[model samples]
Target chain A: ARPRVGYYFTGKTGSQVLTDKIKKLQVKDFQSIPVVVAENVSVYDAIVTMFLEDVGTLFVVDQGSILVGVLSRKDLLRTSIGKQELSTIPVNIIMTRMPNITMCEREDSLIDVAQKLIEKQIDALPVVKLTEKGIEVIGRITKTNMTKALVSLAIDGLV
Target chain B: ARPRVGYYFTGKTGSQVLTDKIKKLQVKDFQSIPVVVAENVSVYDAIVTMFLEDVGTLFVVDQGSILVGVLSRKDLLRTSIGKQELSTIPVNIIMTRMPNITMCEREDSLIDVAQKLIEKQIDALPVVKLTEKGIEVIGRITKTNMTKALVSLAIDGLV
Candidate 1:
């Protein structure tokens, strides 16, 4: 079993817990809706559906719950922007391979977490924790939260 | 002047305008705070204070309000973890310089957003957009939003 999660709202605390706070960021806030596709999902259909749903990211998973890879709208858009016969392509080709994405536990902190994003340069992180059942994802944190917090704290005097 | 920021949760319609969702997965989230440091700030003290603040990411900006580069926790952690006693080491040395990190606008669809945390295997993404005044940060996308969305949609059926 994994540990329970914790949250650090900047409104309640000062900036002293920034590093540790990052450890607590999760995927729970803006996961959108799970649009899981099989490994053999057609790239053409994925891109078409991407726009239809107005979603920018897709998780490519297997019959099991284990994470296999992720596909971004940019990947499909970059590929299909001008192509006409690209719909039949499989998502595995463009999706980010697994073991490459970072997973966080529910109880991690958002503090000092900015370094991980800066190092990788990607926009989002996947939150997970190890358990007897395996790695279970609990939530997510988006840069949007940063923008909100920055503005909030700046107005509240942390700037 | 900056736009008037507001926090209004999007019910089942979702906050993201065009992003794919994770399936049956819960992830971690973070409250990404935007903190800036001057170009001349001491790298040594900056690293120390950043850790104490527990924020993994820091923005290095100029007085003109232009974001120049980003410094991550790993950048400083590497120095501290490796015993790189070069205390005077500048953040510019280890930072993942700008024009390399993928940035996005707040109004953009979360569905098609790139995975900044996944690529670097880090936890956050810095959000910046072009404006008349210069480049300004709007928000960050992290794993936490992803987790929450997954739980709400895939596991909880909120989506």
Candidate 2:
């Protein structure tokens, strides 16, 4: 029965309430600003941008500013050890290209994104927005964001 | 007054129960196996080991099997871009040495470690054990683990 005068028993357990609160969390509420680079940029420049921005992941976009691929520190490290020159190699040749990219939207549930990260064993996910032109990279959601979410949940009653 | 039957009110709110459960989570419950490299190992070899082990962070230990330094993917990536040959440079030269390494114990609260990871802006932490010889790396806790913790918390009632 519905509560009357705010004094009725709700019958919901503590776990149920916690689950409700966690489920309500959206990617937009905890996502960080994204850092991107052009697809034509050299792998060397991409690494430099990664260092300057201090991000583990970088989204690769085309000249029209549409997300085309993704780059990770692991990908760069592997290519650096090879015989090819870092400056001569374009990031598009080595980047994880589209259709293989894992992405989420601002309105997606944080838990669903968290599960994708774990299942895919990836470091970060691009929070994207679909457009008439193409998909646009709007935000970034990494394990760091998930960790922050856990901390906030414990520190506060609701996230 | 306490109820004589099984209907006594505990007077704890849902958030209180959630907080208590989250606070009780320990590092040992979610940590992954630690990956370590010898201090004398070449940076190139260390990167190879990292890829083989498939971990973002690697602990560097001395001849006595004591934790001496920590190597991150960022460290190796930065060195890879330098003029120096990665095969010739010892990891100890590029690794973050002792007294600066952020670590946690097995019994430590997961929430506390999560805070350290965010505060230090690092990728992972070694779960250590103090012996007469030195600190032994027993486990590893990363943002991935924190993400897993969050997922578990939502999937199950308590984690």
Return model 1's CA RMSD, one decimal: 18.4
Question: Model 2 chain A: which ten-residue window has the lowest total lDDT?
Answer: A1-10
Which DockQ values do the candidates obtain, in the order shown? 0.03, 0.85
For candidate 2, list the clashing residue pairs, or say none.
none
lDDT of 1 by residue, A61-126 (tens): 666655677776445544543333465678887788777766554444443343454455544555
TM-score of chain A of 1: 0.63
Quality class of the docking in candidate 1, CAPRI style: incorrect
State in Å the error of residue A76, model 1: 1.9
Superpose all Cα atoms of candidate 2 onto the true structure and report the RMSD in Å to 1 decimal.
1.6
Looking at candidate 1 chain A, the ten consecutive residues that score lowest on lDDT are A12-21
Q: Model 2 Cα displacement at B68 (Å)? A: 0.3
lDDT of each: 0.50, 0.93
